[model samples]
Target chain A: MSTTSSVPDAHEGARNDQAPAPAPRGPVARPGSRLLHRWVWLRLSLLLSAPLAWMVLIYVVALAALLITSLWSVDSLSSEIDRTWTLDNFRTLIENEVYRNVTVRTVGVALAVTVIDVAIALPIAFYMAKVASPRARRMLVVAVLTPLWASYLVKVFSWRVVLSEGGLAEWSGLGSPGYGLTAVVITQAYIWLPYVILPIFAALERVPDSLLEAAGDLGAPTSMVVRSIVMPLLVPGIVAGAIFSFSLTLGDYITVNIVGGANQMLGNLVFVNAGAANNLPLAAAIAMIPIVVMLVLLTAIRRTGALENI
Target chain B: MTLSSTARRTLAVLTAAVLVLIYLPLLVVVLNSVNPNQSMTWPIEGVTFEWWRRAADSAGVREALATSLQVAAIATGIALVLGTLLALALQRYSFFGKHSVNLLVILPIALPGVVTGIALNNGFRGILGIDLSLWTIVIAHATFCIVTVFNNVQARLRRMGTSLEEASADLGAGVFTTFRLVTLPQLRSALLAGGMLAFALSFDEIIVTTFTAGGGANTLPIWILNNMFRPNQAPVVNVVAVVLILFSIVPVWLAQRLSSDVEAAR
Candidate 1:
């Protein structure tokens, strides 16, 4: 709607070519006009420079501040900030049993979630990409995307009801406490499944059906065709989806806090330290651990061209 | 040449099962919200509007809803304008450090939400000594939401090509006038789509909001989080949860429909 209206102005401008030519020539004969053009260009350049420079400056400052805070140690007695630059906070985090446990749990959950989500999403994505008719494909895509559109909090809250002791399971005659590691995994898997599915769908759509038909003509069995042709081609998409889901789940605070119950993921620990404990330095340090890991993983993915595939 | 009937049936069943799994929990919450009994028991003893009525009357719920709407609207607005400007600038001019600028713009959304949240939290509170507030949440959200807008606008700009703008300039319109008329119209659907997506992203965001919202700023998500563990308020929370879910889904559905319309038109 907006783009269509702008066309006429361009058309009108094209019709006005004769007016600027004579004015420019008259101005070109005067020294003042030459100076005016230079001045105008200079001002325009400066005007553009300010916003661009501001963006770069703010990014640098924010990142540097985070790095500095992540390095600082927290006072043992009052749990207040100790402004000295030291590796003590990192060392303490590495050695602390609770921190170690939470860190491992976070990674384990994230990996588990990524693997499960990819496993579930791949077949459906493949079906939509290869098997479904155009109308059916569109319907399937919309179905997959619908959950992503729903509120994150509402999704988590719904999981609480579904997984609670007396909620969906008990009502449906599948009795269980409903809140534990299983519940947490299910919630995270449900929330992030679309993230994995969308990229894989995009990648699978790029593969021509003719190649698959050729494989089938060569007397390859279904399983053999999948293993030899489809899986190999979809590796990059799988990796991209895995990275997205893994990193997102690793840093998530809500899923673990809501569904994990007694289980403390690293994100939950960071949230608590920052919110309840008011231990900003410790929280900052905890936050840095996941950031560093994500950067390394993403860099590896990009170098492998997996991200570009998505 | 086609799949066997049994195989087709199996695949259809599997797809149906997965869809059921995807939607069951959400359906359960909506059903349980109106249950007369407070407990989320099976067979749904009786349907009632008690929880919905309570949720509507709750001051905290209303306040949180207003806060979330206000913050998301402001954040999305800022993101759309700034992001559109950034996209135009990058599209028009070739300059030094362009790669770095592109990286900076993409970094926030590319990085984990926790990292961006922590970075903003640390920068604002520890380094700048500013208290966390609604403004902080808006700023944090805008940082990432801008990327969505930028991606949308830039993609459309690339598709439209430079000829249209150049033709406008050739006809004697000033750059600003050209932008207002020729360029802006072409970018409308992209902007609208981007703005809606950004608003939805900001509305349901919890991680960044947690870091940037101090003691006082209670967004709807945060309010729900606080009440999640309270036994008496669980059903009421369910009502709010349903509302929030509807809020996000509606905009996303509209955006999807808009994009499909654009595609069909083309």
Candidate 2:
């Protein structure tokens, strides 16, 4: 209905376009043409300026400030940030055994979660893409996406209940791991499964069934066809999924606080330093670990074209 | 490839099983909200609506819900404008540092949430010389929420070529008028889908909100975190979670419907 009304406006505008050069113009039309048409750069700049300023001034500058803050030191007695620059925070991070242990633990858990999610997502994604009816496939997508909308804290808290003493695990006869590194891995994998699945499902959908049928017709076994065709195509999507789970798990503090019992990760270290200890410089330094790890992962996977898939 | 019948059955079974496993804990949460046991024991003792009644009457819960709604709404609004602008600029113009702009849009979401959180927190308090408040949270959320809106609008713009807008421009309609009448209607469904996603992302977000929210501000996620371990408030928290889970379906379904409608139109 609105489309029909717009058509008449377009026709009226076209009729005006056919008129002589001295046709009456609205008060706003002249500058609007000068701003939007006569000067292309002006138009582009206007469009780009707000979001670019937001990204640069807010995000980029803040990130740079965090890096610079990591080099500064905090006053011991005053708890004031000493403007004088130093590498003491990084030095402390290097020398501290606890930080090292936490870094190792955080990386290990992130990798575990990534691997578990991928392993689970593959067969399910393949089934959804290839085996399900169109209606069922859409239903499956919604089913997967629904959990992602569920509250992250609530999901983790639910895991805490399941892992607590005399909880669901005990009642189900699969005894809880009692809220530690293992609990963190399980809960994180569950929370991030949808993230992993969607990308893989999208990649799998792109694999043509005709090609698969041709492979079978040409006397290739199902396993050979899957290995040669589907798996390779799935790589970028899988990596995209892996990046999400890995990065999310790497920076998680709330999950650890909820179900990790006494265990702490890089996130917990940063949170503790920034919040309870009021040491922003040390917290900034601690944050560099995940930032560096993610940068490395992203750089390594940039060649995979998974970034676009993300 | 043609899977054998046995393999097909196995895969179907596996998928169903995983789906069940995914829903089990959520089911537990829903049941726990009604469980009469204060401790939330596994076996059902008796069902009651006591926790729901308490949650409805809880002042803290009411305030937190208001705060969350306000933050998510404002963040979604800001994100819609900035994200649409960014998407139009990137999609329509080939400019220098274009790839950099793309990367910048993704960085907030790609990097760890804690990293983005603390970076914004520092930028707000340390550099900007402002105290943390609900507005800081809105800023942080809008930053990341830009990606969803950008991705959706960019994809829509890519699919919808410049033909109609060009035709409108050729017809002597001013730029803003053409955009208002022609381009915007095309982008409406995409904006809705993206905005819905951004709202959901903001509503459920906690990590960044924790860093950016002031001492007095308590969003729903923050409230949930604070009350999760409290002995008397735990069941009420479950009731809140149940309500959230139930309400969550509306936006997801609406977004899905809008997107699918667009897809069918295409």
Candidate 3:
């Protein structure tokens, strides 16, 4: 709802025309009118100011400060920030092979997780949306959403156990990939599946049954129908789902620390630099990677109308 | 579309299998919480309530739970107010820079948690010259948590036109009276869902909490992380996880039921 959606005062008065005549404006009505009616700006200001201050002063300013801090560096021995501005942190990030490798590895794993989630979410989401009875659909949604409320650490730790030596994988006669990038990707994909499922299910629900029937009546097979008609409509939702898994995976450090064995992502790099090394400047610089990547991705998806879906 | 029986059968099987796969690991966690072996090795360990008993007695766990509850409650409370107001402003008044405001609201969630963490960490320590504390965490959480409340309230307001509020206003009731009697009643379920979601989100958050929380404080997630590597505490950690996962259903179910009630009314 925005100002444009709000009915004008004149329109409201028009609706009230059918009602019995209002009592004459007494002195008590004058102050109220002066505040809420005579000055629309005051009403708007009262509603808008506090929240705008919070979003701008706290969130936006903090982000801007972080961007500036990335330009500075620290003195190694003293462990104090040098206020002198330089591109040295960015230069180091560029020249360092480990940072370069970690960046590439994180992006690849994020993409893998997104792909895995989409592949799994599609058929299940479609089933929930179209094939299931209404009660069954509601039950399915609750079943999927319950795990989301479960603690994130618990879920990741559960994966750590499953991939542990002599765990379920071994019990079932399948060798576990055992704590590494593979485990990280699997755990990330699993954690984000419900999230991706909901959006895709909503998108699929919007596809009218008549359109699908028309395609089927025209002799197109199920696969052909999904490929041609439903797929196009599903793209925005898919893009929206992909955003959740990819960005969530990219910035995740705790999951990697638990499941990634010796592997490190860009998150680990930043975590180490910030927490372990206490090199905030370097950490802030490293953070630019994911922020920039996400900004670019968000802008690209805005064109697809996936941003609104999100 | 009328699918062949074979195709429908295949899709159904795939969906069922995926659901099973999703729940399998979580089932393991619940079982592990009761396993007798401290090592928690594979192959059918005997079950016992030892971990549950120990977890109940732990002071650290108690303190962590208390901290987590307080943080979530305060954060959710702040988010509820701020998010509702923002949603009201955005939804009711056409204002300049509304698109920018929308982007601002979405960024905290869309950006990597690490980025949000460090940014707030830096701002709290460097720019603001404030100590990292529970207040900082609540603030950080409110920033991100606003989006859920905002989205819910915005959608609710969109679905509910301004007619009732206008009628109240046209009846000679002032703005505050109209909001109190008409608008708030309309917003009750939406607010309930949004507040529960914000609470859930804050309770589960770790990365940003990791950065914002002072050295003295440990929320439940942080507590779990620290205890996970402690050999004696691992099973108790499992028990804690089980409790939380079990408790998760309440709010989610309530929220779902509430929203469905609205739909059924319509």
Candidate that scores best on lDDT: 2
List the candidate numbers ranked by DockQ, top first: 2, 3, 1
Writing each residue's lDDT as its tens digit, candidate 2 over A1-310 gives 1232232333333322333333444333466563465456777899999999999999999999999989888899999889898999999989999999999999999999999999999999999999999999999999999998888988998888778887898899988899899999999999999999999999999999999999999999988998999888888889888888999998888998889989998887887777788899999999999999988888878865666654
Per-residue alpha-carbon lDDT of candidate 2 for residues B143-171, written as tens digits (9 for 90 to 100): 99999999999999998999888776655
Candidate 2 residue pairs in clash (backbone atoms < 3 Å): none
Per-residue alpha-carbon lDDT of model 3 for B51-118, expressed as tens digits? 99999999999999999999999999999999999999899888789889988998898899999999
After superposing candidate 1 on the true structure, give the runs of residues whose Cα lies further than 4 Å from its correct spot.
A1-59, A76-80, B1-7
lDDT at A17, model 1: 37
**What is the DockQ (computed on Cα atoms) for candidate 2?**
0.56
TM-score of 3: 0.94
Which candidate ranks first by DockQ, i.e. highest? 2
Q: Candidate 1: which pairs clash?
A: A2-B185, A3-B185, A3-B186, A6-B181, A6-B182, A13-B171, A14-B171
Task: Let me know the DockQ for model 3.
Answer: 0.55
Shift of residue A59 alpha carbon in model 3, Å: 0.8
Provide the RMSD of all predictions against the true structure, rounded to 1 decimal.
Answer: 4.5, 3.2, 4.1
Candidate 1, residue A128: CA error in Å?
1.0
Give the range where candidate 3 chain A is weakest over 10 consecutive residues by summed lDDT: A1-10
Off by over 4 Å in 3: A1-34, A302-310
TM-score of each: 0.90, 0.95, 0.94
CA displacement after TM-score superposition, residue B231 of candidate 1 (Å): 1.4
Query: Residue-wise lDDT of candidate 1 within B99-120, one digit each (tens)?
Result: 7877888887777777777778
